[model samples]
Target: MGIDYRGLRDPNAEYTMRDLAAESMGVTADRGGGRDVEITDVQTTMVDGNFPWTLVRVYTDAGIVGTGEAYWGAGAPELIERMAPFLVGENPLDIDRLTEHLIQRMSGEGSIGGVTVTAISGIEIALHDITGKILEVPAYQLLGGKYRDAVRVYCDCHTETEGGAGPPDGKPTGEDPPAADPIAVAEEAERVVSDLGYDALKFDLDVPSGHEKDRANRHLRNAEIAHKKAIVEAVTEAVGHRADVAFDCHWSFSGDSAKRLARALEQYDVWWLEDPVPPENHDVQREVTRSTSTPIAAGENVYRTHGQRRLLEEGAVDIVAPDLPKVGGMRETVKIADLADLYYVPVAMHNVSSPVATVASVHVGAAISNALAVEFHSYELDWWDDLVSETVIEEGYIEVPEQPGLGVTLDMDAVEAHMVEGEELFDEV
Candidate 1:
């Protein structure tokens, strides 16, 4: 192929920018077994799950379609639609180059962070799926191959009345909901371990403690800390060594309060304390992590590897939990893992997406050497696994798919049944 260098600078360039850039990078048509394929269209649909799951599909001229899920947000679907024109006619096999092209092209839309990157992340993931299918390999193989056949999952458990332990009439019955009582919480934890066969679980500690005078200050009262500690003690005692219990604070406390809470939980064999302080201040996060023997996990709020680099460099967290879809797709997450590995920090993917993105996280968990566990956030949602053809997580682990691309096919019937109110299903291929 002859290079037309002036076309690259032309405003009315006939060649797509991606093709020009690929040629400039010496990416030949012979790459990925010389197969020629071009992206035809990109489509998105929202499935209302625990969080609204934004599903993305990239269609090709060859009739092969790749499916992916973006981290849900208000403008994600619109952003993906706007980006579709940039991807059309580009080879799906040049995954990295094309991902960067999208990022650079959409920088005005905040590609460095937020919904723009989330949308691009979905497109990047679909490219991986399509490329893997084109090469007749699993998605994990495209991400530097797998280190494990199955990825262990940690369930994010919740009580029946988590937000408020009150009755339907807003009347305080004599009986409080299980979420408010330590024994009830412990009993639920025991049930999840004994019956569900999960070895790892996470519960929220940022629940209403009833001792708060002001929540905007992010300060936790002594009674609040004591109540949280009681829950931790009870649950840890109930589960014992059968399962590792982690507590999530969701970045809801002050540095002093988080330090106190961490100190209180040091008696038990807690798995980790997640996001004790706001993620913006790395120094505060580092101080909190260094103050306690309990493992500290953070990073779900940030964007690409750049957003996570400071946390790792400053030893802010023991575990780095980057949501694959929210963070910059699979390859960017691999880069994050590689950086965390340098500091010996384990990668525990913070996932709240549907089976599509959950399976995508499993592929990433398989590829990275520092993977600890991928989160299963939808255990309470009965129809979560039904979104896909095969069961995504079985016995608390997702068996790395040996089939091409993401392996499991979407069950369109289930998706159509659960589609968001205003969204339309993907057109038939």
Candidate 2:
């Protein structure tokens, strides 16, 4: 006997697009966060995704890309094992279901940090990538249609400087150097401006102007007022009025610290003060906003709009930056954008990693109505796009091709060549 149509036969239809999406993709599981999920594979490949220490790509027979973002020092493969069974045969396209399942695994601890999200973010990206390929459209189209064609790129070229001077000569602190004085940064900014013929630079404000100056004021001692102001003064002075320079504070500040620094550095004509005082402390962020004229922006550390709505509603920032990969890949980032749109808050997709993320951010940048800019640290790194199937940056702008999926296919050969120690295709993470 066939099943009865309980309410459908009543002739009163109550359904929305969400029901359709849910029905199409369907929800089958809602596992909690972190578990003893063991790894079948420990794949590690270095692309442009954040710091290149190799990423663990956990896969299933379903052909999903669970790109695990293992932190600087943390084991993730083991967690993957505890969660794998709950996900086996579960539909990858059903993002809502997957999110719920992952949330469940997150358990009573109120959720986990790097491992849980990294696993979720990876699976989400693979599923979306598959969906884009299936639909013969880019992932952004799935998130929403294109809102802009080209994404603006901000060169994150870093260099060392001394005492409010300019970028120093010689190799950049040997490929990647620890923090340097403000003068070293200024000289490097000049080189990019004059020699490289580029504008839009990104500088991390961490070095203090001087020890004496810092010790003179308790407020400026650690992650201080002097350091930020010094970096800003040097970079802007060297780049002049022509270039767009953004300071990435990396969420290393207290409310008072950011406010004091923002107020002092306002003269540098900062394009934006980013991730100041962490993603939490929205109240402190609001206080900072109230105190300074600089347009405060934060979100790289933020996940989806679910948590972001609070910060946006509170008017804590002028710009919202959702790191595409970090916030459950592309779709969630778009969801973040939609919410940001309602609040009249402009969004800027954060592309912290390689081409997969960059391509996804491109689509979001193109489709988001209130998108202001797209972040990029890729161009600054060595052979940043070498692993990508396709990448193009022209005149400080990146254009997304109207191709299927993300318009990118990871160079598997290259990935394999650099795969960490013992991961094989069927290694089973």
Candidate 3:
């Protein structure tokens, strides 16, 4: 515990130097984008319900390739295809320049809902990756400098809950449904914390596993609190000591209900109460923070600093979780965190998807001073890492790869193998 900072991994791990990358830099410029690169191919997949992901592989007139994920929902393909005219022959690496251009292009476009921004996010990420590769620095260095050598992780463990993150591929092989009973949940938390080396365990305490509708069974407000308390007791007894316990209200409880529930659950030593009130009410958030000794956290649905200004300024919660993809790109997210850090609030990113997003998130988390942890949900996804070929993460930490760029190489073959049928851009757009 005595700042074991001396003598760690070799700082000079052999990698192609920046000069080497610069020498070979624009190799992809042949396929480079500006406003001229055509979005020749777009692939989309629904990785279970609500887990839709899309990969936009922009092919430049120069014949180089850059990939990005505009995935949030089914809208990814449409967004990419719709913006095709603008992106087809353009430079994918000029993210800021292009974003500025595209913002006007997309202005007055649509609601900029789950789809449009997701598309923009995909393009930004790919450009960043390409730029990183060109520079030969791990993406983290480009975003200033890394704050930590490795990122700490926490598991939502919702996959095991009844309706946790959706039914497990609907092919029940007797997996026992992720220990929904509080005692069993506590046991699982203990295993993940004591054994798995996770610093935090955030249980889905808002509703019973598998049933969103069952939350109504509580009948009265007191019953709801009692039910929540019982669930907390079951797991708190199981997680035992040391590991932090937190609850994600999932925006289920209103302001009053949220504060009441936070107070009730405090006895079990909850670490932070998350998203209890909806993201809209700043005053509600302030009230919740003032009402409870248990810390508060939110901002997953919050966007760029423009979106996060009021919440962070008001000191609404103890921690802030920016959905790296959902929020604006890395630069904007860093700005949001800087504002929060001024208030001494920390960050815990919300990433519960495939490895692509995970790797991008790791770079940002590694670079930020106030980052608490990167949400490690998909490490349990068996074939997940096989999709991306890189050593971006190791053991319980995100190992900053010596490789240039985002440090993640997509195994196209693996992606093709898992490619859901009929997803190939068989037709135009």
Candidate 4:
């Protein structure tokens, strides 16, 4: 004797028939009137390009799927697979619980930082994508709504025509390419600012300018420092006040050398000097920041909030640049930003993945008032926007979409065309 469906729909009741039907027909638990949406499977693939792009897909019982990407590196796919078993059967909407569960479960596997955390970040972002879709709201809403309609973007311009060549291991190509050398870099910066409308840009300053810097000890010769200064001078002169410029050393200098370089570049009114020295020692970075009037940015290689918290609390850096997808997905990044906000520190996201991760970072930057800017690493990749259904960047800003989830779908043709050697698109194990 099953209950009669016809009698269950009382016209006088507060809830609608569709809502009641959704609950009685498919809802898994009594926690809410919504469907449970349990995780069914997780999949990953590596696509080669400037760097290997590690993409993750999470499937649920309700037939909804969420996509995300991890930072390019070895063993992240394997790490995601290792963490997938714990996520199976859990509610996709229980994002915080699930994120903490994965982190706690992988604590033994060195989840404190490195590849393990990166793998979790991919899954965590996918969970946000899933949650946003299930709730029928934009991802920014889950982060407590947005502070701005569009997120400001900063281009990572280089002096090279990278897009004209054949795809590197089948990675996507770009439209117009920018080229190297101080003069060439300055020209490219002017073109990107005036033509592309990018108001902010960064360049790699570690390349030797016909001067030998001790590579082994990370020591800069006087000539090397002067040459680097010359490049900055040329770029600053080119852009004038149209754009804010920052130079990246990629942790290529010793503390003494980094201090020397930072002081020399202060005259250019640079945005910030990035990762001039190794980030392992906070005291060293603090000393460098204290010694320079120019702002110091670091922490892209650091892991989670715990990893970056010390740097902020101890006054180690003026700008905190955490690689969102690699550090800890959306929610964690928001938490990281909030923590930094308390210390009066501005967040500048360090990005190097595909559109999936880049847009994810945009949603995060939109939610946090302390976010200064998000990095655009694929300016020269002509097909960078083709990987997604539509272009997200217009002019120099990423317009936040009002659509549910991440607001973009993967272009399967583009993805499959650039899939890494011997990989499949979310193929089940």
List clash counts for every candidate, in order: 0, 45, 25, 8
Candidate 4 C-alpha lDDT tens digits along 1-429: 323232222334556453555467665323233456678888998877678999999998788899899888999999998887777656788788778778887889998899988999999889988989999998999999999999999999887621222222333344222323678778998999999999999988877454542356677889878878888998999999999998898887889999999999888879999999988989999999999998999989899999998899999999999998899889889999999999999999999989999999999998999998899998888888888897799999999878898887888878888889999876532
Arrange candidates, best lDDT first.
1, 4, 3, 2
Expressed as tens digits, the lDDT of each residue in 29-135 for candidate 3 is 23332234434443344343125556655554444455556546666667666666655444555667665555557766542434466667776766677666655
The Cα error of candidate 3 at residue 340, in Å, is: 1.5
* Model 1 lDDT per residue over 98-161, tens place: 8888898888998999999999999988898898888899999998898999999999998854
Q: What is the C-alpha RMSD of each candidate to the true structure, in Å?
A: 4.1, 9.0, 11.3, 9.1
For each candidate in the order shown, give its overall lDDT on alpha carbons. Answer: 0.87, 0.61, 0.65, 0.84
Error of 4 at 4 (Å): 35
Choose 2 or 3, whichever is better by TM-score. 3
Error of 4 at 317 (Å): 0.4
Error of 4 at 124 (Å): 0.5
List ranges where model 3 is wrong by over 4 Å: 1-50, 61-64, 111-113, 159-180, 209-220, 240-242, 391-393, 425-429
Q: Please give the distance, in angstroms, between residue 206's alpha carbon in candidate 3 and its true position after superposition.
A: 1.5
lDDT, model 2, position 7? 16
